[model samples]
Target: MIVSIKADIFNNDKNSSDLSDLMHFFKKGRHRMNLRKIDDFSAFENSQWKQTLSRSDIDFLKEGMTIVDKKEIIVSESPSDSEFRIKEAYCYLQQPLSIVVENYEYEPVFINCIFRNFGNELITAKDRHWLKFENGGGASDNTIKGMIKELFNDTVFTKSKEKYLRCYIIKDSDREYCTINQDDTISIKKLPEAKFRFLKDMQIPYHILYKREKENYMPDSVYNNFLQTANKNDKKKEFSRIYLEFNAHQKDFFDIEKGFSHKGRLKNRKSLQADVQTLFEKLKDGKDLNDRQYTLIGSGLPFPNLKSDFSEKFNAVNRNDLEKRIEHQPLLRSEVNPADQNERNEFEHIINEIKYLL
Candidate 1:
């Protein structure tokens, strides 16, 4: 985080002692402290705090901070004033810097769209989202295409080049099913080419979901929990029953919102069936079926394909329950299949990339 130290600390001995402690803390290399080239230096020069510092401490302070002409500055106040002053400031350091284009500040993350309930829950989960940053480093759900178009605007793009806006993008791959190769590596049969191209050309870091969408990552526990509290309606009960019975592979790729059959979306059904059939055939000859294959076998032929029985009203209610469950338990790495060594840890990979931006 870029921080600006107030020279007013020189007026008080206690504030000066606090400032000294902060300077020592910065030397541990946890954050970057920057001072405005002219204004901040001039203030420091006129302040009496320097008189309290020895020659080595003065030199260390100078060496520790960087001088920049223009940068977002976190104004450092007296630590004694707030119990969590240091912690709060450190939290800000863990967020991506705001993109300042022509004096306008913008968020660093762009996503296709946020789920009305689930999206907010995932982004705002205390353990997942940055407390100091807006919506976890300010995610903009203007759609990937929309954000790319905005970035391509001549004036905005050209002006932004000087400041170099660092951004990360998260988009649903919308993959029907991922192919598990002979080597156990997973690959998407198809990707949204145009959107990927745009993001790649602009040099933005991005993560495309391995599954169909965020809802696919919800664990079985969430569905079961929802079932227990759900209204005693036949459709609701049926949906829960079918969902609970789904194999891990089916659960991972299933469209939670639309269910197995929505309209004539044959693509989802075909892909899922083909993937499962291939796996079933490959592992059936083995002495014992793996957990994945066992689940596949349990699903049975024709795959109990059903259109979502949820009414629009109940759908909203179910989604809210999803959000609540995820907020409480958080998405586990296992839920996204961290066992795929080729992919490694998908959740951690996304997190590490975001942390890099921060």
Candidate 2:
């Protein structure tokens, strides 16, 4: 799939030009030529019959592109996560590249790395060993890829080519080896365009060449689709179910108008208030306040506990206050209490008033 763009130079059709000029052109500009083929979409955009091959048979069109200019790399560490930037991308011809990176403690750690190729001299590390270096990542592709991910929260891509291939097997994390694939050592050339493309795809605008850059954050159209989920949720709604139980048998009869003793009533009300307060206090203490609801002839405080539409809205005390303030309240609902009869209406109304005291 990745072939030279100049293959059409060998097309032997009648409409093609002579081959001599093609050879001369190659000789003159071979080193500077960019080997990208026509993109699929652009190739299909032309007329069906007028064909793209130049009138010359032996000659071909040279793609207009620039070989990336080399730049000096400023390799340094930063104080915080936001400051680190990816400064290099190394390509490997072999399946796995062994890397020894310095950890945060300055200790060297090793990992095996593989990558995903994004055509036109760019690739991103696909998988890496679990162990990592601390300073950022261990030296090698791990550190570079980690820095890139930290900066853009996206994958990193860098330039590479066949001629840049390394001809050796690394025997250790230090890059030591006895097997040699190439007899000569070659210097690496940094490709800024590849870095540019990577950053651009990561949703970063403005230039990275300067500090204190000003740019607005624009979410991709794909990210915009997330709001579709918001309509299904309502923050103002309370839980529809109530975890409640009340016992008419346990009701305290307080006849204050007849000058009757209210000590028993006060004691019962205080115990109930204490229990309710404990629930709220537990929540404030970051503890769960999940208590079972009892019904009918239960001995404990016989009051209905309101359950919210969601567990996270577990402010039972506040919800009770709001419900009591409302003029219209839902009718009492109890599994054991007969829904077919309103015999317990006066009792339920008195018990529900406990919300006003809490």
Candidate 3:
């Protein structure tokens, strides 16, 4: 299946311009280099000064330029098991401040920087999943930074410049975001409005977002702190901030593994408790577990106490389904009638054990 990805773009930590323009940029004092505090671009170009340039900057410039215009990502595949890499565009907004660009949408939206609405509140897009990018129109007054200041410096912008904190996803044909309808348009459902804040600039796309607590998105200590906040409303805001900040620091580059894969984590562990009985029933009745159940529950429970507890619950499952895979003697996926076995699986004793702690 083809899924489109989108988001607003922010500019940050950029001093390494073209090889030829490096000296001119710094000699004018309009540029700043965070590359180990090296002040001169000419000095940066010197061979010995290579050490001062960030390896990340050099890696990004591998295409021989600083700017990346567009990229295609593989989102999913056909049921026949054929690979399907979805083509996604990262088109910069055309006259973004003056007009709307519709090629793609933004991801993990930064709230404070979204386009303005009538009351300067949340706005809508074509769908509930749409995001807003920072409007890049206002000029900065910090003349000391030169051209870069207007485009890149946040501190230079006057308080008069309006920064809208919300956006909408009604389709352009629906014409919901505009104050005066741009064309004769029809309005669909106006979706939920949300709040956001600016994200820190990072050069690569993110692998995950922390919309809520999950083992992959959060650590135990951080999650424990999140649990400490008493008010439910405040907790929601705090989580939104965490998601925004975490997403802001991520960048999605092309030609890499750039899609969601940890679906096994979404399994309902409590629901799986019933499946555990079916699993042992099949095993005790001379049946076996499938490859998915075995693979997802790899390496058994990490904690010994949890394993001991789980073992007590199912006497027949003392040996984990995962450990049955010997190098040569592979576990069978269809040794019995699949209809005879429980259809819903991918659950193992270890999976439920982890969930019990949460």
lDDT of 2: 0.23
In candidate 1, which residue pairs clash? Answer: none
lDDT of each: 0.44, 0.23, 0.23
* Candidate 2 residue lDDT tens string, 39-118: 42233224231263445521333342333221111111222222212122111111122222233332221111011101
| Candidate 3 lDDT tens digits, 1-358 | 0111111000111322322243332233222222212332233344443554577654533322222111212112121122221111111111121111221222112121112211122233212222333332222111212223244234422222222111111111211121112362322223222111111121111111111101121122332343475367553334322322221111111001111123324233333434232322222224453334333332222223432232222222212321221111112321112222323111221121111111
lDDT of 1 at 1: 32
- Model 1, stretches more than 4 Å misplaced? 1-163, 180-187, 231-234, 264-344
| lDDT accuracy of residue 277 in candidate 1 | 46
Q: Model 1 TM-score?
A: 0.45
Question: Once model 1 is optimally superposed onto the true structure by TM-score, how far is the C-alpha of residue 197 displaced, in angstroms?
Answer: 0.8
Stretches > 4 Å off in candidate 2: 1-219, 232-358
The segments of candidate 3 whose C-alpha lies over 4 angstroms from its true place after superposition are 1-24, 28-219, 231-358
Which candidate leads in lDDT? 1
Regarding TM-score, does 1 or 2 come out ahead?
1
* Model number with the top TM-score: 1
